[model samples]
Target: MTEAAARRAPTRAPEQDPGARGGVRRSSVRGQVLDALRAALVDGDLAPGEVYSAPALGERFGVSATPVREAMQQLALEGAVEVVPNRGFRVARRGARELGELAEVRALIEVPVMLRLARSVPAGRWEALRPLAEATVAAAAAGDRARYADADRAFHRALLGLSGNGQLVQVADDLHRRSQWPLVTGPVHARRADLVADAAEHTALLDALVVGDLGVVQSLVREHFAGS
Candidate 1:
């Protein structure tokens, strides 16, 4: 892998919120707005069950409502936001049961694929991903909510990308983003320690991949989701 690729953060480009920049293409602007909104949702800037208009978000990001609306439409598809009939959109509120189900689906998809990758791929390939994983841990430790969210997404995306299935990586990345959206209730239950612990799982997961023990990999995958 290229050194720059190895040093890349866990989150994919489309998932990054780089703020507004001038002279960008319309399509790219929409993506940036979407990423910004998703980061807001994960960072608790967009509270659950609260309606936010495109124009308001536009003001926040210094863009027009058109792109903001376009971005929100994508988020609506991800179940991260729901469009109001007359209003704009409200953040989707997922309860404990829904969270559990989401976690189950993630495990169902990621575990087997990861296990297969562990068996087929060389340990060095997985080892090359350690820098991205370490970036995630640093983000978690720093307590920058948005950065941590992006790094966490990047780490998992990179991990799953090792399986060499673009479609699987796409789906798993979507699920990961959905899982990170803040709940309707005020304040996130996952504190700094929780984030630190979650970030630490990347190392353990990488170690398991290097060890290539089916049983160990299986246990870690299951326990990781259970803890989530």
Candidate 2:
């Protein structure tokens, strides 16, 4: 095992919910642990391809191994991690090809929906989402990866929500998270300049949306995933 793998240990306790009932409280804590572990994976704190036992992860989060196992199972379903027989779990390693495929999938679902929204929704509607878009840029400028991820998800979700299709938003959100997953090699948003440039793309996308420019919007959508 690598030094990184060796250090995976329960370092803290999971926070408990005081208001909920027995099962609800357990479920709530499990969800919280799941979210924390997911964030740690995205933040590159839990090294990809490094196997970590559920007990160790549970220890780190100050939670029971059961919740950690449940969280890891969810991560496995998301393709963020995989199970190891008689061992534990390791963050799945994805390459450029997988990312490209996800980009293609996202473009197929999002582009047409976005184009339709440009025609149907008023300029003011898109303009109203300007703050959400700007928030992403601000997050990127500050080199806040977690903030950027949240803002990015919010901005895209809001934009896609303009289509008034809940299912579409859910699917797009799943693909978006996969696209943002940290590579086994490292986190993509480590460099400030790259994030700044990507942030500018958000501003440009908003411009196209506000003007209801289908051509520009389509082009920007394709270009947006080019580097991602």
List ranges where model 2 is wrong by over 4 Å: 1-22, 184-190
* Per-residue lDDT of candidate 2, residues 1-228 (tens digit): 223323333344434566655667677767877777766775577776789998887777777889899889998998888999878998878778888899899888988887788788898988998898889889788776656777888999999998888999999999998887873343544566677888888889899988888888888888887777
For candidate 2, what is the lDDT?
A: 0.79
Return the TM-score for each candidate structure.
0.83, 0.86
The residue-by-residue lDDT of candidate 1 on 1-228, one tens digit each, is 222222321222332255646535667767777767776776677888899999887776777788889889989998998999878999888888888888999999998888788789998888899888898889878765677878888888888887778999999988877788773343444577777888888888888788787788888888888876
Which 10 consecutive positions of candidate 1 have the poorest summed lDDT?
1-10
The Cα local distance difference test for each model comes to: 0.77, 0.79
By summed lDDT, the worst window of 10 consecutive residues in model 2 runs over 1-10
Error of 2 at 50 (Å): 0.9
